[model samples]
Target: MKPFTKLVILLLSITFFVSCGNADDDVNFRLNTGDGLGKGKEVDECLNLGENDLILSIQEQFTTLPGKVSILFKVSDSDQNPISGLTADQFTIYEQGRNDDCFNTISTSESLARISPNSQVFSNNTLLVLDLSNSVLSSSLTELKSASISFIDNVMPDTAQESFKMAIYWFDGENELHLLNDLTISKEELTMAINGITDDISNDPSTDLYGAVIKSTDRATELLNASTQGDKIGAASVVLFTDGTDQASRFTKDAAQKKVDEADPNISFFTIGLGGEIDTQVLTDIGKTFSVFAANKEELETTFNEISTRVSERANSFYLFEYCSPKRDGSGENNLAIQVKAGSKQGAVQTKFDATGFTGGCE
Candidate 1:
């Protein structure tokens, strides 16, 4: 696609999440194809206000302001290796600053992540970045395919599996980064997409992983931020699989990482390196705040299984910490020492330090 044309697609895709159009239009601008488009809207024919009714426009609006909180944690077992597979049942959750008038009350005192009792309205879609750089790697992609099938079968809740989709994109081919929509929800279709995976090294047509990651993450942000059915949407992590480094990307690693962090503060990232030439350190650092793995298969099967476990539990429970100041102008240097303890574990992140900027009424 031409650069200008691709830009148009990118902007159109971003429209799914961004609040656009006003009362006159029926649809909100930012939309997530993965999350499904909004159904039709009810027109407010009566512009006049009544005791219980007010005629407003159709476009969506952002009513909530950004909540500020810093979270930090350290994962360790008795032997000090980061452990996985524990469910929400195994931990305790807590919040500080209850002494001040901010939130209603402390939910718990143990500092574990609070699992919402409500049915999850979110989707955890994984966009698989398959590697097809060489013939041997192409064969290995089949193993990856088998692993992918097993992943869907084991990890996803049966009812939501159709909603929890996966997209396939292979590097170094005629259409190297195209989304395999047929494979998005079907194991059979995924198999077909993988079966046809091949490596392309032509000069006129090329592969650029940086561009792909940027594009994928941009798409993901839209999916997460979209609102449907009068509620906002959410997503888990992006699991990336690649056998090689960024050989032809338009953007640098720093730029991509910054973009991701800005888009969604809570979205986790994970990666899988399929072969020997993969950059283990780069992948590890890329997901430094979240999770990352790059390995060859003497132990990769085990790695993938562990990846499944992490994602499953994370989908069930997420940690949210909130800290706030007292009313409008009541200011004293608000310094807090907060800690989250799970079993015998202890973690503390520096909350906002001395500040005096809130001149208006606190929420």
Candidate 2:
């Protein structure tokens, strides 16, 4: 065969194999193209490239795409009732990425209410890293169960479009990574998985808090890369429930904390120190690695409730406003001012925004 002819055939064969192989692994590269002006049904459907576009040397800037925005939240109200039927215009979001107006502004309320058309991954994955070592199991178990049920029942509403992808792991004896269920909104399934856990069940024959926490999130890091969204997760976070002691494990508490921090700065590690035996120093360091979190049991439940509520609020609400030009003499980063505008004719531009920098980014 002539060299040119042989090369042509070889290229064709490789292309053919890649096109039809392992559909699941086909990372949702599908670029959604439209005028960005909210158009017809076609605009709402995520686009899968066609043979015609392929030949045109079409390039999709999804990775370098600066406008992509993402946030994971549930729904609730001041009284904590599940708020339903939100619209895209009701909320606002401001985005900032490293080293880059890499900033983005868009109305996500509609996307939040319904499933985002552009996103292939449905569930926003969450890891509930628990400490089940016998050392602190008795006191923390009950609270953990209550929190787990509340999390499954309320925070993660079982729906076909969106839900929390959750896993429950603990270190009771040896390392116990209980059930790492794939992202699903099945209330029954989640409840069963969370409550079915028995500290008695061990991944090994001995105690393993550090082992379980470290390993669970390590696995989660890999999973979140293609986290349900079928894309790389920018802010994958964790809701850690632990007493914060490392009596048994292949890794130490410091090692686990370092790993998690480097894995995802957005991984919010919220700990629940159930008893005095709970190691506050270790957990505090863990939580501090991500964001400011409570350190004691009295504060633990409050923190859990607060964290859950904030996440839901983020889901249900939106921030709406015109971008203000940054000051010429000031630093590139400008502190934004946001007010509820609950009532018209509110006094001077009230400074409603706080150090947390809205959306609970924790400044």
Candidate 3:
């Protein structure tokens, strides 16, 4: 081969290898910016601690004038099961400035970092819908009431907070979704409402399961819209319990499913079915988030408790993590990463925030 041709071929090979190397680096350290409340971008510059057993998804983040940085995020395991009751002590903050090659560890104690209440920026609402048809009212009303009270006890916090609230609604053959109790933070009020349910409460013998699903989804959408009107982020759950299929035929199954499908993404649907008469497939579709079944009334409370546990975990997963940034006004934008350690598992997420006006009076 000619000398010039040999040199050209060698140059092309080197260029191709270099391009492949850059592509591999991009893939290895790719960053993901999630959507909605879990909104954050991963930082490629930060060190990878290890295989993440836990996933920290940032919902929202902001900065205060006096150098306080606030980040709201949800924690879940690799299986997507939420991890709750995590304290600020479990978190470690790292910040990277323009001059730093990587993140610098920030002292949690020195930064006055803490996990604050999310009431100012986050809200979670739950709508518990019950079936009061003839079958349920006559045969399983007592068991249903007991299970519902257990659900309330398990889901509600010991102390009430404005950010967490629940409302109760019941349905029968009638087209209306009757309100058993308005939204309240008091678990006692919810339990009392459940206990007040009597066999005579439903005059109709038919069941409007589809109607109830539609109405409850509408109510949940309204609540989400109201909660998110300002700067707050909101989430809701619709937990519906029924012992049988829809009998009234007032609404089509497709309509109910469509309502659930088109509802706000922030709203989650959970359904509980009891006895052999219920259709598991339909309930599973409606309860896209989760669905539980009980072979008979004997297992009702346990099934309700399972759903309550999930609801509570989901609500508690959101953390309002705040800390005083060491960055000054001229620092421009800095890379921030939060690592959380829970038992044997750990995970981290990274994002950027401006410290253009940051100062030193954080509380």
Candidate 4:
């Protein structure tokens, strides 16, 4: 090869490598300013926290009368697993005004920062669909009831909140999806409804698994639509438990899978299967978010618990962080950064808020 040709090839290779590296860095460091909620825009002048272990995706942010700023966001680890139970003390608020060279940390105590309830603007619903066909009713009714009660205890909060609720439903060979209990925040009500299921509850001997999937997806869609009225944002989870495949064949597998694939992104699908008769592939496909299996009835409770942890974490990851800003009127637009620390891992997100109207009293 000629020396000129070799030199040209080396230059091209360097250019290609540098371009790829730049693209990767853009994706790795860019923060996500969420859509579909409130006013959250990208801040080009904001500081880059650079390769943190946590991600805080700001969904909605707004300033209320009298200088209170509220930001709603979801917290997750770098691996995308939700981080729940973070208190206001874990957060450090920093603000930079037009006159300041750098951001100044605001004292949490003086600012009266708090993690308030998000019920006014956010809602989370879970639909627990159970398979009570003749096989499960006669063989695993006792175990199913126990597992369901444990699920309710683990998923429901100790104190009831209007924003969080769960509903129970069951399916058999029949063409209908029977409602065991309506959506409610009370765990006792859900537990009682599950405990009341008897062997005679399901008259059909076959399973209409596909039909249940389609119907439950429809129900979750309705719940999400209803919850998202006015300025509220909502999310739903459809959890299905089955012991066998679609024996009735009333609905085609393709139809069921398409429903799940085309469903809203905010809605998550989860499936729990028991015994050897269940099809792992179908369940895994239907439960795109997560899936768990139990080889026997004895392991039913454990599988339910595993799913419970995920559902709870997803619901608790969202936070309504509110604080009083020190910047009065004429500050115009200022940069704000929120830093969260969980053990050794820490992450920060930066955005801007306008303080057009000055205020003194903020609660």
**RMSD of model 4 against the true structure:** 5.2
Q: Tell me the spans in candidate 4 whose CA falls farther than 4 Å from its real position.
A: 1-48
The C-alpha TM-scores of every prediction are 0.50, 0.51, 0.87, 0.87
Q: Give all candidates' CA lDDT scores.
A: 0.46, 0.44, 0.90, 0.90
RMSD to the hidden true structure, all candidates: 17.8, 18.5, 8.5, 5.2
Per-residue lDDT tens digits for candidate 2, residues 1-363, read: 999999999999998888777553443222122111011111111122111110011111111111122222222322323333444444433323223233334234422322233233233556666665554454456666667677655566456334355555555555446654555656777678767766665444445656665776676676656653434222244666655456565677778777755655334455555555556767666654233244444455566676666444433322112222212221223222111112221111111111112221110
Residue 164 alpha-carbon offset, candidate 1, angstroms: 3.6
Q: Predictions ranked by lDDT, top down?
A: 3, 4, 1, 2
Q: Please report, as a residue range, the 10-residue window in candidate 4 with the lowest summed lDDT.
A: 30-39
Q: How do the residues 138-218 of candidate 1 rate in per-residue lDDT, one tens digit apiece? A: 446556666665655555655545335566655553334566543255655665665565444232233455566666677
lDDT of prediction 4? 0.90
Which of candidates 1 and 4 reaches a greater TM-score?
4
Candidate 3 C-alpha lDDT tens digits along 162-184: 89999999999999999999999
Task: List clashing residue pairs in candidate 3.
Answer: 37-59, 38-58, 38-59
lDDT of 2: 0.44
Q: Candidate 2, TM-score vs. the true structure?
A: 0.51
TM-score (C-alpha) between model 1 and the true structure? 0.50
Q: Model 3: how far is 136 from its true place, Å?
A: 1.0
Sort order, TM-score high to low: 3, 4, 2, 1
